[model samples]
Target chain A: MDATTVTTWMREIETSVTQERDRLVQLDAAIGDGDHGTNMTRGFAAVVQALSQDQEAPPGRLLILAGRTLVSSVGGASGPLWGSALRSGGRVLGDQATFDGPQLVEVLAAALASVKDLGAASVGDKTMVDALEPAVAALGRTVGEGASLADALEAAAAAAEAGMRSTIPLQARKGRASYLGERSIGHQDPGATSTALMIRALQRAAAASS
Target chain B: MAIQTKPRKFLNDPADVVKESLAGLAAAHGDLLRYDRAAQIIVCKDAPRAGKVALVSGGGSGHEPLHGGFVGRGMLDAACPGEVFTSPVPDQMLAATKAVDGGAGVVHIVKNYTGDVLNFKMAAEDAADDGIRVASVVIDDDVAVQDSLYTAGRRGVGATVLAEKIAGAAAEKGASLDKVADTVKRVNERARSFGVALSSCVPPASGKPIFELPEGEIELGIGIHGEPGRRRAALGSASEVVDVMVEAVISDLKARAGSQVLAFVNGMGGTPQLELYLLYGEVDRKLRAAGVVPVRNLVGSYITSLEMAGASLTVLQLDDELTELWDAPVHTPALRWGV
Candidate 1:
């Protein structure tokens, strides 16, 4: 993957976040505060601004900038979690001028670990982790099997979507849904949906790059 | 009809009231608060100390001292204030995370509102992309909307304070982000809250009440946004109101035969403490009769519904850990202890 590929992914993430904004907020309304759509829109809009202005920055640096912008802009729990994921992923990428499938997997793994450390949400918490963990694992497995970058990302995106759907039956163990006790089950986890969007953005970006 | 003069005088424009109020609040509480005017963020002036995981939270305007006033040594690391009753746009939340993130990572304590949850989720994604480890705990202790179809879900109410106090102490003791998150989840599980609004709030800018109610009637399960409640009922005595509210909270707690609990009697914005304590008196008695021991108690306005006249009751089953944290020193302007 090259800088252009990363840029394409960033653009995809922005678009996906925008497209899914209302849906995510609607899900959140089921078990959370009702500002997910507005919040995501504001954060992604900022990311787009940052990416568009600093075209010469390396992919990693651009991601780091985006992460910092998010941390400084978005409010609420997700801000720090997503910001850390990007920052951690960017750190892992370092100054590498380009990253192949294996390198992407490593960065993703590191990003996932960083998110886990920050959110403390495990696999079954009915949180973003539900989607993110599965997607990252799928990406790693596909890359390990020597699939092309686009194919690995596609697999990850599919896994993430499945994971997001799986959250519908989960009794939330993290975030606001946990407050509902057993009632939290039966509704889709908003965070998981957003996580799926993030992974799908990666897949779309990779396909575009190819 | 005669036009009435506005009573508020501290603002430049009606639109600027929330921001100006926050500015004044920060100045008065400067020792404990560091306000980011541009970002509309507030942080505990001292943060990121080794061995302490930061606790952060936030929401819209009107709930002053809520996400903001709670910022102190034992409460919150940061708070992002949003527009009136609207969730803080994500930009503020993102800024708060960066300010409070101390290498050990930060835990965002959120209310269970759709807007608040979504914004926080997006911010988490952004944070993930960055390197700051972030965790979130969504508080949904309110039990009023157990069966509502018109609303998003159950609203977060009184239990927010209990969650913040408990989680803040846990983080202060150097609990890992996971431990803090779990502790928050545990409290949410054991706690339940219910509230009734006696009146509706008038937005600072609009200067008109969001909804109108008959003088002799009260909205039974009124949410903070002046949303309709579970049902309307005649305005009753303090004891009578407390009975209904406490009953709702107790039933929702699902406490076993002999569980001990911490009770918080919170005042909505326009309610005075005198009235709150009167209601608390009834609540304390009813709780005793219910066979649940009131292990600890808090009575005051920790959370508000703009300027609405009402109160909410929160009951949490307490264990050793929670009790200890509840007893920890907290010095926020709204609630002060230990220090």
Candidate 2:
């Protein structure tokens, strides 16, 4: 995958978040402030605007720009969570014009760690980590098995979707929802849902390139 | 599926609520405040008074009279208002910090929410890069939840108002940024708050309650954002509710017999001032029975949610310095004394 593929991923995320805007807001409304949808939509729109202004940037630079935009535009916990992830991943990618299979997997691992560090949340906390950690691990496993980049992303997206669904039965251990305690058990995590959306966007972008 | 009842709010477009609120604030209190639409910051007209430490505090917009209303002489130098229930971005804070920084430097009075803390940390770093000295004190006095979505520890609630007043007074006295910060930290340590929500508040943008409370039920330990409380219990009489809120706060603060404290009974926007005064009476009675003296008291809607029908009680054990600062002249829209 190259810079165009990366840009495609960002574009796809913008579209997907826009389409799922109400759903994400409803999910957050169940346990949060109900602005996740609005915040994510605004953040992605800003990302697209920033990216468009500098279309010829390297893949790493594009992701970094998107991350910074999210951090500044989205004014909630999700801003830092998603922003630090992409920023750390972009830093590791370090001006790479192209993201090969191993480099993509490396970015996923680094991004996951960065988000976890910023949020202090881990898997089973019923946050974005519920989706993100699994997707990263699935992608790592698939790539290690010699799968193509598209196949690995597809597998990761599937894992993320499953992880998002799995949040339905777990009580939240972090975020505003945790204040609900046992009452938070039945709702899907909005952060995890958005994470799944991003993973699916990545998979679609990779397949489009193939 | 049943039809959902959308909350009724008086406003134009939700998008323009924050902008218009600032406009109204600026219009009403132009003598005290100057609003910068581009920067979304409310600045004291007399900010950056030479050689005085400047104080800045802000959060999401719904908690009105909080950050913005507290901006003036002997209080906050500036307030950065974010979208409702969302943290202000770094740019807003950076601008406020820079615009208000006197030669004595600027101090950020940040609430303990994750978003606010992260954004303020970023702004402080950004200001440092610009050669503006910045220090910060994080207020985490809500003892209801140990850690919640936006906080790693206690949530900053009522004490934020008190901290701003006391610290703002310290700054006005020409204290160094470090000294002002130390005073703010001490204020935070000496304060504790607990809140109960009789109903949920709907942000203008969401157009729905953040959470649902069954009829005749109350959410105890509720945060200012209308976030879920520590527990949901059957609604009780005003005295009962005040008992629960005051007792929990006292226990959390370990208030023993003969402890002199400043008690604040804060209205959560929708609640009437009459009810807040009633609640304050109950709180005062309980503290006296527990051998705690209510030395100074503030009863009103200073820090509030947007039309959330609830109240929070804050207990601040005060020393001589804190009491003196609290009594210091403060001229602001929401709070005033010794003017």
Q: CA shift at A173, candidate 2, in angstroms?
A: 2.8
lDDT of 1 by residue, B1-339 (tens): 348568454557875776788888889999988778988888888875665788878887777558788888887888888766666756777788888888888888888775578778877877888888888888877787763433346777777778888898888877998999898899988998888888877665445465577898887765665444656799888888888887888887778877889988888888998998988889899998887889799988778877789888889999998999889888886778788
Q: Write the residue-wise lDDT of candidate 2 on A1-210 in tens digits.
A: 788887899999999999998899889888777889988998999998899899788988888998999888887888877888898888878887887888898888999999888778888889999999999999999999999887888899999999999999998887777766777889999999999999999999989987
Enumerate residue pairs that collide in model 2: A175-B149, A176-B149, B114-B150
Model 2 C-alpha RMSD vs. true structure (Å) is 1.9
Cα error, residue B120 of model 1, in Å, equals 0.3
When superposed on Cα atoms, how far off is each prediction in RMSD?
9.1, 1.9
DockQ-based class of model 1: incorrect
Off by over 4 Å in 2: B1-7, B147-151
Q: iRMS values in order, in angstroms?
A: 8.1, 2.9
**Candidate number achieving the greatest TM-score relative to the actual structure:** 2
